[model samples]
Target: MSFLRSLSPLRAWRDLRRFLALRKPHEIGFMVISFAVTGTILFALYKDAAIPPTYKRDVLYVESWPLSRTDREIIDQQKADLIAEKKRAAELRARQLKRQAEFKRLDDRLERLGI
Candidate 1:
């Protein structure tokens, strides 16, 4: 009980009061800057919460229509182009892999021949 009495709330309050009273100009400036930054962050968060996302405004829950014949033909043409491009890419990748394997085989043969 005596030890607890020695470290009382009143003493801590007084110490905190004295520390605040003894703040220098630079310390006061830093404290003001920190408060301003925290206020700006809180204001930004408030603004963000008030506004809805752009996607919700533009696209979400919007009605869609089925394609017309011309639109469907255009989409089919685009799909065929994409499939051709993918096939070309796969062929290029296979050729690259084969070239790499051939280089490795030649390197191994050169090493075996001590050259």
Candidate 2:
């Protein structure tokens, strides 16, 4: 136990000297900078990967409207009916304009006849 005690003090002193010798000023500075840079990069990556809890919302159940085959057929028929109605309206307007021009020509003829 006495021998062990003597060896431990010497070993501790040797270890201390070795540690002090290995830590040069430039090496210590480089280690400090490297650790700071690694810590910063890891922190940035962790923050980027983390999801914010404030944005989480509650889920809601939604009911959908059911469409049968007959309903789809009716919708298609209505679309066709609307297109036909639009075409009929356009034709009616064109005929009305033609009749108005004919009426204007008749009025001009009556004016020339002084009636």
Candidate 3:
């Protein structure tokens, strides 16, 4: 798109520089330290030498994204609870329909008696 093409890399860099210039010295130092730490962690994660050949990269990456064996167990338990809840809901719905039918029968009897 023409709009996307209009975005200049130099302009973005200049904007970023201006934004950084507005920050206090302590804030800038904190930002730099955080960036360094994050970059180091990412570099370590993706660097081929840091990974063992036996482990697939996808498995290694997925293992770190906040879900482990205990989490899986919890998820499975929740799914089971959900299924039980659905079954209970269906039972309640059937009871409700039966009650509604009984009420309609009573209403029809009252109409026939002119009450």
Candidate 4:
């Protein structure tokens, strides 16, 4: 069929050679510019039309308690959670401070060594 024949690399190469041999430089430049502009427009349109991805990363997972739990239990759980969060934050701050101190010491030693 015509479609299969058009798919031949040899035929396509010959056509390209023929076009280059026959066309003016300005004609080729215009064709190249036209193709580039048309391609960019089509790509933009395709991107806009395509469906976006749904991400589970946007959903924040939180702890769920039983509906049968009393108000006092809920309050206690909240307090415990807050305490745990604070402890974690404190630990992170301590780690960061320790790292900063170590880096400062290393910098001082390096400076003494003229490095």
Candidate 5:
């Protein structure tokens, strides 16, 4: 019986009214803004958690070529891959050499300063 009385809608509304009545308008505005921000964040999190993804997965790194490619095509692809790999290696090597040169120059400067 006591639990049922506590659950009454009229009492709940009265309590809510009393609580709101005690709050300043600016406090209520801040509370409303806080609730809006919190609700927006929760909604965004819920959307991000959805199954089957609302957007495509990050840059799918699968082969775009057909499975029944010709042998010559495969050889060409291998050649292209080797060329690209060599190009990247050459670029990285150049960068490394430049960095080493800079460090050597700094070392020589420090040696001249006798530090």
Candidate 6:
């Protein structure tokens, strides 16, 4: 039964031919152009898919002094300076808050004395 059903290539081809024959000329032209464009795009992509490997020099030489203890010390000093600046900023904020509180107290005292 399945073999008989599978042997329908003639019917399929006939249906396909009938469908194509019924299609308008403009519709057929557009379909052909779309297929050609898709095929060309796929071919272009397949052709350019490979990347060539690159070569590099195996030997290297130093013309100047590499990183030393002094470089590390300089980096450490910069980090310490940043930390100190942050601490100074925090202290200044605390001082400003204290000054604001003192000013509020003075204003209250002056208002109480009516002066």
Per-residue alpha-carbon lDDT of candidate 4 for residues 86-109, written as tens digits (9 for 90 to 100): 997898789889989999999999
TM-score of each: 0.36, 0.37, 0.40, 0.41, 0.45, 0.40
Candidate 1 stretches greater than 4 Å from native: 1-69
Give the candidate number with the greatest lDDT.
Answer: 5
The candidate, 2 or 5, that scores higher on lDDT is: 5
Better by lDDT, candidate 3 or 1: 1
Q: Write the per-residue lDDT of candidate 1 for residues 1-115, one digit (tens) a residue.
A: 8988699889999999899889998998999899999999999999989986533233447545455658777789789979988997898789889989999999999999999
Question: Once superposed on the true structure, which residue ranges of model 3 sit more than 4 Å away at CA?
Answer: 48-115
Tens digits of per-residue lDDT for model 5, 1-115: 8877679788889999999999999999999999999999999999988757333354647788998899999999999999988997898789889989999999999999998
The per-residue C-alpha lDDT of model 4 at residue 16 equals: 89
Candidate 5 stretches with Cα past 4 Å from truth are: 1-60
Q: Which candidate order results from sorting by lDDT in descending order?
A: 5, 4, 6, 1, 3, 2
Best by TM-score: 5
Each candidate's clash count? 0, 0, 0, 0, 0, 0
Candidate 1 lDDT trough over 10 residues, lowest sum: 54-63
Clashes of 4: 0
Give lDDT tens digits, candidate 6, residues 1-115.
Answer: 9888877889999999999999999999999999999999999998888656433454756456456659777789789979988997898789889989999999999999998
C-alpha RMSD between model 1 and the true structure: 17.2
Off by over 4 Å in 4: 1-64
What is the overall TM-score of model 4 with all chains considered together?
A: 0.41
Candidate 3 lands at a TM-score of 0.40
